[model samples]
Target: MSGPGRFISFEGIDGSGKSTQARRLAAHLEGLGHSVVLTREPGGSPGAEDIRALVLEGEPDRWSPETELLLFTAARRDHLERTIRPALEAGQIVICDRFADSTRMYQGLRRAGLRVLVDQLHDLMIGQEPDLTVLIDMDPETGLARALSRNGGEERFESFGNDLQAKMRAGFLDLAAEFPDRFVTIDGARAMDDVTADVTARVTEWLA
Candidate 1:
């Protein structure tokens, strides 16, 4: 919140390649002699990692939308206390794979009118946003195929299938429009290198 270090987060549909891009950005910043902390939501710290397993590895309907929101909020609180805030306070760039924006899309859109609840809980528990939010926008069907092919154990959300992914893509774009100052939308349909180059250029300019 009141730190010299910058916070950056990447958000997208499940297979938009944000995670890979996050890792690359961290490494790039580190190569430039910056101290960096690369982490992810639902699991940035020890306690949060435990919570990640619960929410990410279950069936699509394992938890009600409200229940899932609570779990995610708890994980984010721990992540903030144990990982994110500490790094920022120490003047280290923190690159997070996903943040509150993910929750807004995933759970908030799970049911009609749940977004209000999501925003309320976020304001109450986790009152933070990234300095920069990189949104990798991609086509839902293609993203779904990429997500399913990974065969990651954490496929609870992906198991919901393509329809959800379509909604998520639209929702992410809407968020970018809503929060224009911090959000940068990138076309993820390009080759990975092209996407990476564009992202790196944009972030480097921002840092400068």
Candidate 2:
């Protein structure tokens, strides 16, 4: 249980249950005697949390994809500087609910040519990737329905509807293919306990 810290990230279309899985993984690791830090993007640190409110609330068009990209990047930078890096340096397992991949899909795929911008800013400002990324795959329609039911005031992205969810699902799968070494895809459209067991098993294997 003593070694270099591991950084784990969870990603999926809205309502894919990545957040729940991420939290479960963190607690599971902690119960196994590993130090764990469970955090989230767009709002991990104080400054980044402030930015999260700005980008994740209001109308769907509250900010253009470009502006949203910038906001996300800025928040990520702050999160890295103030939260992630420090936790990693202290040799704690860092489980993040979402990371740059979310930005790549949500903002990058919203419009053509935006993915290039997403990568550029990511390389320039963040330049960091998690050691492991768990992508929870779920049906777009089902995911959208679940998201809408949340009524989580921060439903800005979910407000975009099923079209975006479908696009994001495909994009996330592509990203998994593109980064096979660190990405693991799991079915999120199952019972929560089933999904949690799969995630725990896969992540435990990685840690081993």
Candidate 3:
């Protein structure tokens, strides 16, 4: 835990294959002799995972937008302290499936004025952003279809339906534009190998 390490996060709607790409990238980097830590937000460290269960389970309206944001931020703080920072200090590339960006889109966009709250909370609590964020861009229809096919209980966000997914897609795109230096937007509709190749190239170039 002494050297500079890379931090990367994958983001997209529920079924945009961001998680798949994150795993693939971790493997690819490891194959190249890099130490990689593959993790996810809302749950990465043990404490965060417990919070994830609370946030992801129960009803969609289980918590107010403000309450949900606080929960996510708390989980994120634990994750950063227990998982991300230490791994980065150890010089291992940390590839997270999701991070604060998901909270920004999920909670921020859920209400009209909540985006400010999400940003303020993040700034006050979780100040780290990924060195590189791979955003898998896909149509909401396609993404939702893919997500629903999985048939999992973690459907709270997915249950928000197509319209919200579409907005989330746009929000992600806006975030990419907002942080051009660190964001890599990739088309997720392509074949798996093709998408992987694109993501690999971007990360490779960044690592160079």
lDDT tens per residue, model 3, 11-37? 999899998999999999999999999
Candidate 1 lDDT for residue 192: 97
Per residue, candidate 1 scores C-alpha lDDT tens digits across 134-199 of 999999999999999999799999999898999999999999999999999999999999999999
Instruction: Give one clash count per candidate, in the order shown.
Output: 0, 0, 1
State candidate 2's TM-score.
0.97
lDDT of 2 at 79: 94
Candidate 1 global Cα RMSD:
0.7
Tell me each candidate's TM-score. Answer: 0.98, 0.97, 0.97
> What is candidate 2's lDDT per residue for 1-208, written digit by digit as tens?
2137899999999889889899888889989999999999889999999999999999988899999999999999999998899898899999999999999999998999999999999999898999999999999999898888998899998889888999999999999999999899999989999999999999999899
Say which prediction, candidate 1 or candidate 3, comes out ahead on lDDT: 1
Higher-lDDT candidate of 1 and 2: 1
Residue 55, model 2, lDDT:
96
